[model samples]
Target: MATHSSEINGPDVNDPAINGPAINGPAIEVDRLTVRRGGRTVLDGIGFSCPPGSITGLLGPSGSGKTTLIRALVGVQIITDGTVTMLGMPAGSAALRSRVGYVTQSPSVYSDLSVAENVRYFAAVFGLGTAEADRAIDDVGLSTAARQVTGSLSGGQRSRVSLACALVARPEVLILDEPTVGQDPLLREDLWDRFHTEAAGGTTVIVSSHVMDEANRCDRLLLLREGTIIADGTPADILSRAGTDSMDEAFLSLIRHSMAGGRSTDEVTS
Candidate 1:
């Protein structure tokens, strides 16, 4: 992780384009977000912002509310307190629905369908046309596999297909939960390159992942522990705060500090 105290800019935290959100606009903003499962609190006062044109990775251990947070962002989970705003509107709302694209942990595509068929299905579901859907498939380097049976594809290949399906609608906010889970390191690297390319092209991307190295590739990160934000900032900011050279070391140091004190990082955002 890298650290810099200077304020970072892009879209607000929720917008997919975190680097240059709507030419001086916040893409996503959350304030005092909290979520509970049944009666158990899963997230407590969680808050973070992502501007457009940048990539923000949601990192944490298993059951740390990473999925819960992503679900809240994409409208699958409701906030018990606080608010989640995307593109200046509430997430999961009808207005944000057209502008927000999401790929869940499961491949949401039909295994029996062809790659192109899956893209077309999503296009129809998203109200996008063939031309745009085709372009999106090409964007993710899945053009060659368009005619193949999706179930026959390899894991990495399926991941790419899922990504392409998500992009078919050209949504401003793209939320991905464990997008690269099954991919090997090499393919994962390639996916990150594609992610960067998408971000540079002005897409706001929020991804959830347990892969530390993949998290390092993000422009900014929100680290979660026990369903709460333990650290939030650019990688460098976290690294500096942890007083370590590598992000892994920084994360370990921060975890140790938290265990010693029985607390998350002291920093809290409104």
Candidate 2:
């Protein structure tokens, strides 16, 4: 996927007035994070840290607890144990509300409202104005559908509307759960570009996807299987360490090694 660096007309990430001082330390830190649902542990002792101004991909198949981890980071999911720290504060802190933007797997926009109306409503909730709303809509390539009712839009368009709501906040940390599930190849590329642009501007983006191919676009990757982290490292490093050319092959190799009680290649390198 191509990464975009072009300026979008929202809050200037470089402006001190908007971003404040350059943030030090990891944008996200998770230690022994665990979550249980329906008497079963959904996320078991997951640990990782995402550096500031980087794009991290959470790659796994469905039922691998990708969404659960995202919800935990955004302070929505109830965890059974462990801690998630966001930007040096505890996850779900009131102060982090506006600083963290989240887009769920399902669209969260109001179906009765037009796309523009939804953006405006969310912007207001974020204490922002119409200019921010408009910029968000434009950033997601929804300018043409701005006036259409969200319910009348296609699945992909509605998804974009949800994304627009998140972007309007210009959050320092963005967590997206399967944002490109049904998107066409072109739109997927465009969205990845937008993510890269946000990261370039010092935002920490954690995106979850089940697609192994998309893993290549991220700066770092956390491979998960059945609620456990199987590998964590750069795509190139993972490939090299796994002795494979493709992420799919690399993932399988890592899994086999993990099941055989061998340390992950990532562990050896780190």
Candidate 3:
């Protein structure tokens, strides 16, 4: 069995001090979250909180439950136990339908439609106007290709279209799963910049990726292995605690320590 460490600054959803005033509580909170698929536990007692206006990176290899966790947060996955609250309401509530934006790993767009058309469609679905949809298309650097047919665009361009649709709603919480998978280095950098811009504007951005290099771009990181979070904290904090200079090294150090049956580096440091 894999052991997990408690979050250092766990937010209290009920306490006004944590949830009141300036709204000091987290934008998303998961408590003892567990998920099962096909009779096997995919996520085991996971817990964490993503603060408002922050960029949280979920880092884990394939089948590490990164996708599953993201689905749970978006209120799509059925969990066997635990709870997920987003913006003070239960995950997947009807009210959250417009306040939360989700972009899956695979691009979900109409191949026959123009890039701009796709964004416009989703924007309307979210009750947003045409201007919002146009801005979102530009935000993803797809303005020049907005009139191009989605099927004629490259894989990277198609992916950006999906991202634009998600951004069109301008949701308070944005969840992206492997969004940069097929993007070029320049496109990836631009997308990261956009993510930070959104966070600066008070949007909580939770992104999931298997790439360790992207960890440094996040305000905080949650490192998972086999559904268990082994490290959770700022990138610099994780490196300092793990005695590593890089995110990859930090992950390896934590993995080695866990394999040795020792306390998680995060726990020891906390």
lDDT of each: 0.81, 0.89, 0.87
Error of 3 at 188 (Å): 1.1
Model 3: how far residue 266 lies from native, Å: 4.5
RMSD values for the candidates in order, in angstroms, are 4.9, 4.4, 7.2
Q: In every candidate, how many clashes are there?
A: 33, 0, 0
- Best-first order by TM-score: 2, 3, 1
Name the regions of candidate 1 deviating beyond 4 angstroms: 1-24, 262-265, 268-270
> Candidate 1's residue-wise lDDT over 1-270, tens digit each?
122322353224334345443545567888899998899899998777787777999888898888889889987797799999888778888877778888888787888999999898889888888888899888877888899999999977887788889888887778898989888878778788878777766778898988887777888888888877777888878878888778788888776777687575456232
- Residue 73 miss distance in model 2 (angstroms): 0.2
lDDT for model 3: 0.87
The weakest ten consecutive residues by lDDT in model 3 span 1-10
Estimate, for each residue in 37-103, the C-alpha lDDT of model 2 and write its tens digit: 9998899898999877789999877898999999999998989999999999999999999999999
Off by over 4 Å in 2: 1-20, 260-270
